[model samples]
Target: MTVGYVMLCHTALDRAAQVARFWAEAGCPVVIHVDARVSDKAFASFGRVLGDLANVSFSRRYRCEWGTWSLVAASLAASEQLIARHPEARHVYLASGSCLPLRPAQDLADYLAKRPDTDFIESVTTEEVGWTMGGLDIERFTLRFPFSWKRQRWIFDRYVDLQRRLKIRRRMPAGLVPHLGSQWWCLSRATLKAILEDPERPAIDRFFRRVWIPDESYFQTLVRQHSRKVESRSLTLFKFDYEGKPHIFYDDHLQLLRRSDCFVARKIWPNAERLYRSFLEPQEGVQIRAEPQPGKIDRLFSKAVERRQRGRPGLYMQSRFPRRDHENGKTSSQYSVFQGFAELFDDFPGWLTRATGVGRVHGHLFAPEGVEFAGGERLANGALTADASLRDYNPQAFLTNLIWNTRGERQCFQFGPRDHQGVDWFMATDPNAQISVISGAWSVPLFRSDLPFATVRAEAARLQRIETRYLEILRSMYVKARVRIWTMSDFIENPMEPLQAIVDEISPRAARRLTEPPQMVDLTGFGRFLQNLRNEGMKPTLMGDFPVNGDPRIAAPRGRRPYLVQ
Candidate 1:
């Protein structure tokens, strides 16, 4: 059986080398995605240790989002390219940037030879409603982010406090719901192809646009939908303490890794040296594949950031709260509706109002701007509106409408039904321009309405000008940083057809050589721009918010941006 190992990577070049070395010894073909933010010098520095093995290849460099589809998209793109490069690749396993092989590659090949048809991915029916990061939402399936927002330091503390004081009950956006699970996945080539060649790919794409972390779900949910037989549990090792962070592999956790019966466990810090050795130690009657011990570096690495809770007297305390757990697995529409406003108004109301020009913005929840009494509607602001649609909408009718709109034949982007209420549909176009206006990361609900189009377009144009001006101001910064790629905040999510048209219109001038020689962040029509640039014999670097895979690439570590120090 032909087996392929897909290594989805971001940082820790030394550890990546160790893992790659282990897999190389197993004779498994390996592909790695090096993040783009890593300096060329740094990548070259690590390349010596990583060495060139016949089985190992590096991905084109790209930056990755923390909890979005970028992660999944990057992986899928890498897998597609990997298969294209090595057609003999058979079983493709999605391993994290920080994963190591527990068994010989040949042993894994033998194991898969026994079940060619069965995909080892974790999958389940939407009916089961199991442990998803966001309950039943497409966001759970489409988005990718290297860092956990819930685990990150208090970037949104005021919102959390406001939520507690208001005792607010949020619901899923109007058309979107959430489904969450483990991000690590393994799959057969057939299943992987089905995902890439899905006839309803547009529908899936739309669905995940609103889903939280499409990276984790894109393959998982699709395999469950298309494949006949699937294992519901992710085969890799993933265990969490009460706080929901994966128990970092410290020396103390070595015994536990041996007994867990898992294929891999994330995320060892680069500092861990001893754990790598322990993984090589032999145990009585334990086959290499079934052995429980960790690699030598596993024990010596410091605790993963996931395990650390930077507590303060009043600022932060790690809690076993449902919200924290659900942040990874589930998010209610009630919560998201409030969260939409929270991310907007609570954190930086002035900046938002100035950008969107919404006067007296208290909390512009996307409650249906219509008069209605039934189906979870309430009279507020002298007009009757629903706080959310799906909350009490007719389920059968609602689901039918959602599915219908999401049909591939439709011209406009159509995400399916809401996993929650009052939010956008399960899949929606990204609010790229509005996101730029608000100076926030890509998120749904920011562009949940058709009404925002004119405003968004206007703001997008203005922002382009502003961005151009900002680029001019930062010319020195760009030069000093040696940045070859520039990411734009000007793109908006919605009706991608027009966006593609825009990309075709302006992609050329945007990529024209800057005075300093760095590539400008191509907006809208980047897909064609990339082609056009290549045709012009100008190999301009791409700085997409999402990941792309081929050859080899490197990304900067999260929180370790060159501009900032921890």
Candidate 2:
């Protein structure tokens, strides 16, 4: 016996007619079900196009809505008609209007003839199903969904919530266990007749009328009671994304669909001329009699789902702008943020470039004037301009874009209290940032400036407050960056070790040790600068204890020479 097709059409009646004609010409009886929503003129034209086929017939019209009882009712009516009219048809394949046959119809008939009793339908218990979306699994069976989810979402949600709060649950019809799977299925004639003619069908239908998306579970659950042998898989290749939406096939998916070896695939683009022309036309030569293997393309669909959900790290695009703290990765690659280094050293950027042997070092990128890109270029990588206003508009995007654009190369930039402090918390929370901070180094610039003592003292108080608040953020529990903080007084005592550690972390692959360290600016009168600030009633707390005499580097004279006792 040949296979019979029961197609459910809602839109794109032209394409549906084409597929129906193709199946009817292949000696398979066709039964079509049109949604009542279609215009009368369109329905008449659709019927006229397929009226030449004697085997093709239209079932009773039903107004179908997604996630409601209408779809199940439509399928029931169409399937019953298909079974009665085409009694020679041993198997009934339920497909959608958009489903295109990927293999020859005769090949499918041959495959089914071998396994006459086997019913191909995806059936699994709620506990075993992991692909359910919308937080509804067992609740779908237990809860009552009377309102349309698409049209009356507000009422639907409130009704579901009200039912949940009141703890209302409906009893399932006795002698039947609920099962879930893809709506599409290929059932044997015996099983279809058994499900349609069951004495308790009226009760089962009444119970499932209030169920959510009953079309998926109606046939799937009932088939278990009637079918002697169930394969627990669909002959049709249907795939959904992270969101519960089906993946639509286009012309570009020609090879992808061919590799699946599935008898039919659904949700094809109506305008994909290439896909329709290539798949609808008969495939010649020896046909592969292998079983339908949807798993062959599962990896590609998994990647597509992952890419749609998590997206590429550090990429901020219109399609996917992740919520705060929800990014796959805050930055694309590793980078360095040096605080107080530029203020305490004469030529820190130049020295760092020479030390690393890679000249990817820039001055304060967030300088109030403009972005100080390397070599003072007007535009940086990714066509990022040096406009201060634009950079300040979105400092976080600027930094992320910089790191993303220069992914292969490591980025190094200087930061200080004088520059914009917008990205302080962002850098501290980013795992890719390597921050080296020398506390209270902002006072150095004030000390050497030829300004009045009152002016220096006022500026020192302002900067000291900003730095103190910044240090608190870095020390907080939420910080993810690699942080190394040293008091200015302590860093001056041993600069080589910290420099070596910072350089080593930046370039771990470099086998050589740091032989040439950045030259430190002379701190002859720096100690007096802090003592002077303290004298002005402003406590310089961030900087470690300093000798009030002057420079901490100078050695004190001894009253008598001491001899070592050996």
Candidate 3:
């Protein structure tokens, strides 16, 4: 029995892509239904990454107005389509774009296949028990409007406000008590087929047409009523705060995420791209741009700082040579390079020889000052260029050595470029793949403008130029490699002031789609950036460090634990 995951997505293309990518490796065919109200451009952007996959599908754009039947109706329509398209699928797990698999795909599939008789969903009556009003009520579940509420906010705002203030309680008709549970559910084919084919579905649907929030409750009520073996607890994982808002994940939650036994989680912001990359296996075709070119000692050292800081230094470490003599004019030419700096700096010759020339570090040797780099020609502007070079002096090397190895102790490199203009390369075999920039800083400049202007302005412009250059280079690289992410490294560090003009100058040329746009990942605030970005129709990613208060939820406790041998 093959179990598949069906994601009901609405205007969440990037997330859909992420979910699809995660599932692809898990061997599960995915199907997505974008609420019809989503723009064609949004669908196209999602299709660009997911279109090639035979397992994914998009529902015809159907209007899903809030507090309307359209939302529930749309979900039913999409689910039916998925069932028709993939008849062999034994079970259908309905998830939102925000959902992420918590368990390995194999485990979830195995669990589902073993439980063919049971339906995993959350459902319970709230007839006598009062539940939170707005967004998830029975009234809202059955009601469906033609357009999104926000689009008609001007007209709907007064009514919504009035409804909120009135605290009006509508009595449920006889035998139509409200039931509520998790928005996500996984059900067997038999149950889903029965629900879809029910001749009395219209009767139930008609009764809930006046309900407050039907999307969340309608499915739960119907599934519970229909399934013989329904699990009250949702198998998918999510944590909500006391206020009912879903808990947002940050870097601090990494440990918890690793420990989570569920197959997926939800509500991850778009800016969490780095976290996504870290969780996935290293793609055979994906090449990190942070490594130094082989044989280029200067570039190697320059790249070491970024690579080491991130705890993932690359090839450069193999040939690293430390500063043997701090005293002026001490010749290092005879210092054998056979052994790495670990041995050379230890004041001992562990493996030094003259035959292979592998360990010789002769500092006395000097090439002509004007000699150009090897494998590279001079640019039209008369600047020396090289794909590979052995240089004694460079800005990257100088800065890196000063910051990390000034004391001649163990040094590490950063994973990304340390200096602004330190060109990084992404090697892709194709020439026209997609490359996007996914970071923005509208809030920083808007809020911090009152401070000193020149330094802030200069810094913003400098970063923007680097970002622009990165985009340009990425475009070229994508032709060969298919680079899909262009996240802004530092977006929210701007001055508080009017930054409209500055933002306009920094924003990139609009493309056909923004699979990866400039999104602000404000590690400093309670996702203040998310609020602003979403308001502007720009999807932002949440890129904060885990354990904000140094909490170890995302990390291990400092001490060791004893084993239990009962």
- Top TM-score prediction, candidate number: 2
Regions of candidate 2 where Cα sits further than 4 Å from its true position: 133-135, 139-143, 165-167, 512-515, 545-566
Runs in model 3 deviating more than 4 A are 127-131, 134-177, 282-566
On a 0 to 100 scale, what is the lDDT of residue 202 in model 3? 79
The whole-model lDDT of each prediction reads 0.47, 0.90, 0.50
**lDDT by residue (tens digit), candidate 2, 1-566:** 89999999999999999999999999999999999999899999999999899999999999999989999999889889999999889999999999999888998999999999999999998889998878888898899998998999999999999999999988889988889999999999999999999999999999899989998899999999999999999999989987788999999999999999999998899999998898788777958798889999999999988888777888877667747887778998889999999998888988888777753898889999999998888899999999999999999999999999999898999988788898999999999999999999888889889999999999899899999999999999999999999998888878888998877787677744877777777778777888888899988888787787667655456598788998
In candidate 2, position 209 carries an lDDT of 95
TM per model?
0.45, 0.93, 0.45
lDDT of 3 at 326: 21
Q: Evaluate model 3: give its lDDT.
A: 0.50
Report model 3's TM-score to 2 decimal places.
0.45
TM-score for candidate 2, please give it: 0.93
Compose the digit string of candidate 1's lDDT tens values, residues 264-361: 67766556566666664333465655533334334332344333442211122246232322222111110111112232222333332333322222
